[model samples]
Target chain A: MNLTIREALLAFRRAPLLSALSVTTIAFSLFVVGLFGLVAVNLQDALRGVAERVEIVAYLLPGTPIEPITLATKDIEAFPEVQSATYVSEDSALARARAELVEFRDVLQELERNPLPASIEVKLRPRFRDADHVNDVAERLRGFGFVDDVRFGRDWVEKLDRLRQVAAAVGLVVGAAFAVVAIIIIGTTIRMAVLQRSREIAIMRLVGATNGFIRRPFLLQGAIKGMLGGLVAIGLSYGAYTLINRWLIQASFFSNEQAVAIVGFGTLIGLFGSAASVGRHLRRV
Target chain B: MIKFTNVFKAFPKGGLALKDVSFHIAKGEFVFLTGHSGAGKSTVLKLVYADEPVTSGEVRVSGFNAADLRPRDVPMLRRRLGIVFQDFRLLEDRTAEENVAFALEVTGARRSSIAARVMRVLTQVGLAAKAQAYPRELSGGEQQRVAIARALVNEPSVLLADEPTGNLDERATRGVFQLLRDINASGTAVVMATHDLDLVRQAPYRVIELQEGALVYDSAVDESRDQAATP
Candidate 1:
C-alpha cells in the first residue's frame, strides 16, 4: 500500500500536463451533472412545499361563531393525512394580502372593511398532498354546516406535480449521460498513462512484479484525479448556485441543507465514475 | 536448475523459433547459448523464465512446468529466476538503487531488508558508489551493472541473460562477463545468450549453438545429444 501510493505520487508528478487535462475534463463534466442535480433537488423541494400547501380553503359563513370555526380547525388537524389546519380571521387575511403586496399597502388601507373571508386552511402532509387527495379532503370539509364554500387548486396541483416528474426524469437522463462521458474521459487518461509507462510496466513484469503491483499505481492515480475533480466540481457548481441565488438576489434556489446533500451525492458519483473507468482498463495494463 | 525437453516455439507470424530443443543446466553451471541473430537463442532463455510459453513439450524451471503454470503463479516462478535484457530495461527516471530495489519491492520484501539487499547487490555488481546516479547519468557499462544488480537483488536461483553485453564495447563486455562469472561462482546458475563468439571463446563454459532453430552443437554433451526435430 505504501509503495503503491509513493509510485502513484511519482507518476502524478511526472505527467503534469496530462494530469491537468484529466482533472479539467472531470471537473467540467461533473460540474454539469452536479448543476443539473442541484436543479432537480431544489425543484423537488419547491414542489414539496407547494404540494404540502394543497389544502382545502373552507370559507365559513360571514359572522360565524368562533366556537364553530375553532371546532372545524381542530377536526381537520386530527385527520390522518392533515398536517395542520388554522383559522384566519378576515382582518388577518387582509393583513396577509397586504404583506404579499407591500407596494400596494396604502391602497389596501383605503378599503372600508376586509374583503377577504375568514376561513380554515387545511394543509396536508407532503405524502398525501396531491390533487386527488386534496380534493378528497375538500369533500369532507364541505360537510361542515357553517362552511360557506370549499375550494382547492386540484387541476393546478396535478399539473405542477406532472411538471416536477418530467423535470426529474429529464435531469436523471442528462446527468447519467454526462456521468458516463466523464467516466470515459477518465478511462482514456488512464489508458494514456499505461501507454506512456509501457516500458516501466515491461520492466516490472520482467522483474517478477505481480499484476496487482503493476496496476495499483495507475488505479490510485485515477482515483486521486477523480477526487480532486469532484471537489472542484462541487466548488464550481455550488459557487454558481450561490452567485445566482444569493449575490444576484435570485430567490427560491436550493437551501443550504439541500445544497450540501446534493453536492455530497454528486461528488460520490464522480468518485465512483472515475474508479470504474480506471478499473475497467486496469486489466489491460 | 533448468531443463528443456523437446521444446518447440512457434512465432505469431508463422515460423518456428525453436524446434524440439532439449537441454539441461545443472545447479551452479554457467552455460552460454550462442547462435546468429534470429537463431532462437533468446527464446530458450525466455522459456526458462517462463516469459514465453513453449509451443509444445515441456520447459521446467525450479520444478515448475513453464507451459502448465497458472498465470497467477507465473510471478512466483519468475521470483526464483532473475532476467536481464540487452538494453538493461531499467526505469530510466529512477536512481541505480531504486532500480535495484524495484525487484525486491515487487516481492513484498520488508523496507528494512530492502535497503541492505539493494546495497549488497549494487556492491556485488561493483556499482555501490553510483547507487544514487540515474540511468542517464551512468555509462553504458555502469547502466548494465545496475540492471545486473536489479536481477541479483532477488537472490534468484538462476539468472537468465539475453545478450547481456550486446551493446557494450570490448572492454565493457569483459567486465560484464567477469561479473557474470563471479555471480556464477557464488552458486547461482547462469544461462546467457550471446552471438559474440569472441566472448564465448574467451570463457571456458559450455556453449550450445543453434542453426536455423535446431541445436547444432552442444560442447558439454556427448555426440548423441543432437536429437532435435528433423524439419
Candidate 2:
C-alpha cells in the first residue's frame, strides 16, 4: 500500500505537464456541458411558469339572459381542468378599459353606450395548463349557447412548447457528443502515461507483477485528475453564474438552488466519465 | 527443478531455436548450460520460466507444465523462480535495497517484513554497506550482485542466471562465480548459461552442452560410467 502510493506520487512528480493538461481538458469540457444543461433547465422552468398562467377569455353574446351567464360560470368552474372562472360584467370590463386607456377616456365618454361585452376568464389547473389542453378546454367552452368568442393566445403557447422540445432534443445530442470528446481526451492522457512508463511496466512484468499491478498507478492518476477537474468545473460555473446574475441581469438564467443541484449532478458525471475512459484504454495500454 | 523433454521452439519468422532438446536439473544441483552464441541457452531459460512456450514438447518447472499454463498464470509460475540476465537487469533509478525489495513488493509482501528481508539479502550479497547506493553509483560487479540479491530475495528454489558475468573482468567474473557457488551450496538449484569452457573446468559438477539446439554432451552419466569402468 505504501509503495503503491509512493510510486503514484512519483509518477505525478515526473509528469507534471501531462497531468495538468489532462485536468484542464476535463474541466473545460465539463464546464461547457454543465453550462448547457443549466441553461436548458432554467429555460424549461421559465416556459412552464408562463404556460401555467395561460387562460382563455369567453365573451358572452349580446341580448343573452343573465341567468345563463351566471350558469355558464358555474359550469366552467365545475370542470376538472378549470382552476377558476371569474365573471367580468360588461360594466367592469368597460371600467378596466377606461383605467387602462386614460388618453382615450374622453373619446370613450363621447360614445353614448358601452360596447364591451360581459365575459368570463377561465384559468386551467396546473396539470392541464399546456397548449393542447388549453385549446381543448377553450373549444369545449365555446360550445356553450351564450359564448360568442374564445381567446387564449394559443399561437404563442404552442410556439413556446415547440421551442422547449427543440431545446431539450438539441441539448441531449450535443451533451452526448461533448461527453465523448471529454472521455477521449482523458483516454489520450492515460495512454501517454502508459507510454512514458513502459520501461517500468516491463521491469515489473519481468519481476512477476501481474498486468493489473502494473496498470494501477496510471489508473490512480487518472482518477485523481478526474475528481480535481470536476471540482474546478463546478467552481468556474458558479462564478460565471454569479457574475451574470449580478451585473448582466438580462443574461441571468437559473435560481441559486437550481445551480447547486445541477453542479451536484455534473460532478458525478465527470467522475464516472473519467473512470470509463481509463477503463476502456487500460486493455490496450 | 527444471525439465525439458524433446522440446522444440520455433520463432514466428520460422526456424527452430531449440530442436528436440531434453535435460533435467535436480534440486540442490548446480549445472552449467554451455553453448555457442545461438546455441539456444537463453531460450532454454525462457522456456523454464514460461516466457516462451514449447513448439512440440514438454517443459515442466517446479511441477507446473510450461506449455499448458494459462497466460494469466504465467506470472505465478515465474514468481516461484529467480532469473538473472546477461545485461544485469537492474532498475537504474532505484537504490540497491529498493531493487531487492521490488521482487517482494510485486507479490504484495508486507511492508514490515520487506525491510528485514531486503536487509538479509543485501547482507548475503556482501553489499550491506551499499544498500542506499543507486545502480549508476555501483560498480558492474556490485550491480550484478544487486541483481542476484533481488533474485534471492524471493528465496526461490531454482535460480537461473544467463551469463551473470558477461560484462565483468576476470576478477569480477570470479567474484560472481563464487557467489553462485555459495547460493547453490545453500540447497538452491542453479542453472547458469555460459560459453567459457575454462571457467566450467575449474568447478566441474555437471555440464549440459548444446549444439544446434540439440543436447550434444551431458558430463553427468558419461563421467560416472567412465569412473566405474576404471575401477
Candidate 3:
C-alpha cells in the first residue's frame, strides 16, 4: 500500500500491453543466456568424464620382487596428486588383455607364456587430472628402479587438456557476449517503457515531485518486470532441460544458487536500466 | 507573489522567446496575461514557474529565485504553485478523485487527510458527483474542472493557468472562468494566460498584454497614468 509500490502497480494496470511486452523481451533475452549456461555446464561435465580416464600405467620390469612392488604401489598411492594406485600382476594383466581385446582373444589364450608385464596403474585426483600433472606422476613412477616404462597416453592427455582450455575460453567469451546482449535489449525495453509514460512523468514533475520521487516507481516497476522475466526464463530453461533429458541425453538443470543468480541478474538489470532511462528523461524534460 | 525583472528567454534552436519582459503580481491579485499565439505568453508563465531557465535576468516566484535555482529546488518552488495547461493533463487511467489526490500524494501528504482534501476540492470545482469517473469518461469542461481541483488540492498561493479553457465550449468556458474567479476570491492569486478577449472583458482584473515576446501594454500602469494626466 506504499505510494511508490501503488504507483508502480498502477503502471502495469494502466498499460498492460507495454508492461507485458517489456517482460517478454526481458524473458527471451535472459532465456538465451540461460541456454548458453546450460551448454557450458554440460560441456564441463563431459570434459570431466574424459579427464577421469587420465591414468599412468607403470609397467614393471620382469623378475621384480612382489614385496618391493607392493611397497611401491602404496608409495605411489601416497602421492598427493594420485587418487589411487592398483598393482596388476603379470598373470592378471594377461587375463585382462584376453578379456578386453576381442580380436586378440584366441592368440592371447594360446600364448605359451604370459607376455604382459606387471604394472602399477596410478589414477590422479580430479583437480590434478591434467597433462602437466599426469606427466609429473609418470616421471615419479619412472623413478622406481623396477618400473620398465611409464605410459600415460601423453598425446591423449595433452589433447584433453587443450579441449578443456578451449571449452572454458569459448564459454567465457560466448557467455559474456550473451549477457551483454541481454543487458542492451532489456535496457532498450525499459527505455521504451519510460518514454511511454512521459506524460505522467511531466505531470508528476509539474506537481512538485522530486526526480528521486519520480524515479522510484519506475525503478520498482522495472525491477518487478525483470523479476517476472527472470522467473519465466528459469521456467523456460527447466522445460528445455526436461526435454533434453527426456529425448536427447541426461542433462542437468541449474543449481538453486545459479538459478537465483539469474533472477538476481535480471532484477539488477531492471533496476539499473530504469535508473538510466528515467535519469535521462528527468534531465531532458 | 511573482516578480520578473527584465527576463530574457532564448529558444534552443534559435530566436529569443522573451526579451526584457518584466512584471509583478502581488498576493491575492487576479491578473490576466493576454497575447496572440506565439506572443511568448506560455514562455512567460514557464519562466514564472521555473519551467524554463532565465536567459539573462531575475525571476523570483514565491521566494524561489529562478536565476540560480538548483534542479532539486525547482520542485520545491512548484509545490507552492499550481500549473494548468490547455490540455487537461489528467492521467486517463486514474479516476477524477485519484487524479486530484495524485498531486497531494506526490508531496508525501498524510494519507488520512488526502481523501477529505480531495473531496473538498472536487466539491469546490463542482465535480464531487463525478469523483469516480476517469478522465475519458468526463466531458472536456468536467475534465478541466478535475484538473483545476488537482491544482487547488495543494492549497497553492498562486495558480498559473495557461489557456485553461482553450478546449472548452462557451458554457464550459464560462463555468471554468467562474471557478477561477471563485478560487481567486478565496485569497489565492490567479494568473491566467489566454487570447480570449471576451473572457478578459468579463472580469475587472488587471491585464498584461504581450506582442511577439515583448510587454506591449499593461492596463494597470497605463490606466493609472491616464487618470493622473487627466487630473
Candidate 4:
C-alpha cells in the first residue's frame, strides 16, 4: 500500500501536464454536479421550511361566546398532530388590523368597536403540516357549529409541491448528465495515462509484474482525481452559495440573521453528497 | 533448465514461424541461439520466456509448462527470467536508475532494497555514472545496458537476450557480449539469439542453429567440425 502510493505520487509528479489536465477535467465535472446539488437542496429546503410554518386559522361566528372559542382552541391543541393552539380575541384582531394600517389608524377613531371575529390559530407538528394534513384538520374544525371558516393557503401548498416535483425531476436529469460527463472525463484521463505509459506497462510485464500491479496505479490515479475533483467542486459551490447569500442580505432580501436562518444545514449535506457521488463514479476507472 | 518437444508456432496471418522444433538447455549452461534473419532463433527465445504459445507439442521452461501457463502467471514466469529486446524497450520518461527501479517496484520490493539493487546493477553494467540520465539522452549502447540492468535487477535464473547487440558498434557489441559472458560465468544461464555468426564463433560456447523453423544443428562447434572433416 505504501509503495503503491509512493509510486503513484512519483508518477503524478513526473507527469505534471497529464495530472493538471485530469484534475481540471475532474473539477469542471464536479462543479456542474455541485451546482445542481445546490439548486435541489435549496428548493427542497424552501418547501420544507414553509410547510413547517403552516397553520390553520378557524374564524368563529360573530355572536359566539369567548368561552366556546377558548374551548375550541383547547380541543384543537389536544389532537396528536397539533403542537399548539391559541384563541385570538376580537379586540386583538382589531388591534392587529390597526397596526397594519397605521397610516389610517385615526379614521374617526375607527368609527365603531373592533369588528374582526375571534379566531383560533392552530400550529401543526412538522409531519402534519402538509396539504392533506392541514386539510384534514380544517375539516375537523369546520365540524364545530360556531366555526364560520377554516383556511390555510391551498394554492400556495400546491405551488410548493409542484416546485418540489420540478426540482426533483430537474435534479435527476442534471445529476445524471453531470455523472456521465464526470465518468467520461475521468475515463478518458486514465485512458490517456494508460497510453502515455504503455511502454512502462509493457516493461513492467516483462519484469514479471502481475496485471494487478500494473493496473494499481491507474486505479489509484482515478480515485485520487475523483476525490480532488469533488473537493474542488464543493469548495467552489459553497463559496458561490455564501457569496450569493451575502448579496441577498445586502440587497435587503432579508437581514443578515434572517439570511443565515434561510440557508440551512441541508446545503452543507448537499455539497458533501455531490463530492462523494462524483468520487464514487471516478473510482471505478 | 528448459526443454521443448516438437513445438510448433504459426501466426494467425504469417503462417508457421516455427515447425516441429525440439531442443533442451541444461541449467548453468550458456548457449548461443543463432540463425539467419528468417530463421526461428527469436521464436525459440520467445518460447523460453513464454511470450508466444506453441501451436502444438510441449514447452517446459524452468519446470513450468509454457503451452499451458495461465495469462495471469505469465508475469511471474517473466520475473524468473530476464529478457533483453532488440529495441531496448525502456520507458522514455524514466531515468536509467528509475527504469531499473521500476522493475523492483512492480514486484513490491521495499524502496530501500530497490534503490540498493538498482545502484548495484547499474555499477555492474558500467552505467552507474549515467544512472540519472534518461534513455533518450543515452547512446544506443547505454540504453541497451539500462535495459539489461532492468532485466538483471530481479536476479532471474535465465537471461534471454534477443539480438541485444543488434544496434551497437563493434566496441559496444564486444562490451555487451563480455558482460553477458561474465554474468553467465557466475552460473546464471544466458541464452542469446543473434544473427552475428562472428560473435558466436569468437565466444567459446555451445551454439544452437535453426533453419526453416527447425533445429538443424545443436552441438559444440569443434565437435561438429571434427565430425565433418573426418567424414
TM-score of each: 0.86, 0.82, 0.92, 0.82
Please provide, for model 3 over A88-143, each residue's C-alpha lDDT reduced to its tens digit, 9 standing for 90 to 100: 99999988998899999889888998888999998999999998888888998989
Best by TM-score: 3
The two-chain DockQ for each candidate, comma-separated, is 0.75, 0.62, 0.78, 0.74
- TM score of chain A per candidate: 0.76, 0.72, 0.89, 0.75
Q: Which prediction has more favorable DockQ, 3 or 4?
A: 3
Cα lDDT tens digits, model 4, A1-285, are: 776677678778989888778767666666766666666666666777777767789998888877877777888899998999988888888888777888878972556766678889988987676677788898999999999998888888667666767877888888788767766665666567666776666677778877667665665666676566656666677677788788753211223453332232222332333344333433332
Per-prediction CA RMSD (Å): 4.4, 4.2, 2.5, 5.8
The list of candidate 2 runs beyond 4 A from truth reads A1-7, A35-55, A58-131, A143-148, A238-285, B196-198, B221-231
Compose the digit string of candidate 4's lDDT tens values, residues B81-127.
99998899998888999999988888778776788899999999999
Candidate 2 similarity to native, TM-score: 0.82
- Give the Å error, residue A247, model 3: 2.6
Place model 2 in a CAPRI quality band.
medium
Best of the candidates, lDDT: 3
Model 1 ranges off by over 4 Å: A45-53, A60-72, A88-118, A143-148, A245-285, B223-231
What clash pairs does model 4 have?
Answer: none
What is the DockQ of the complex in model 1? 0.75
- What is the lDDT ranking, best to worst? 3, 1, 2, 4
Candidate 3 colliding pairs: none
Docking class of 3: medium
| Candidate order (DockQ) | 3, 1, 4, 2
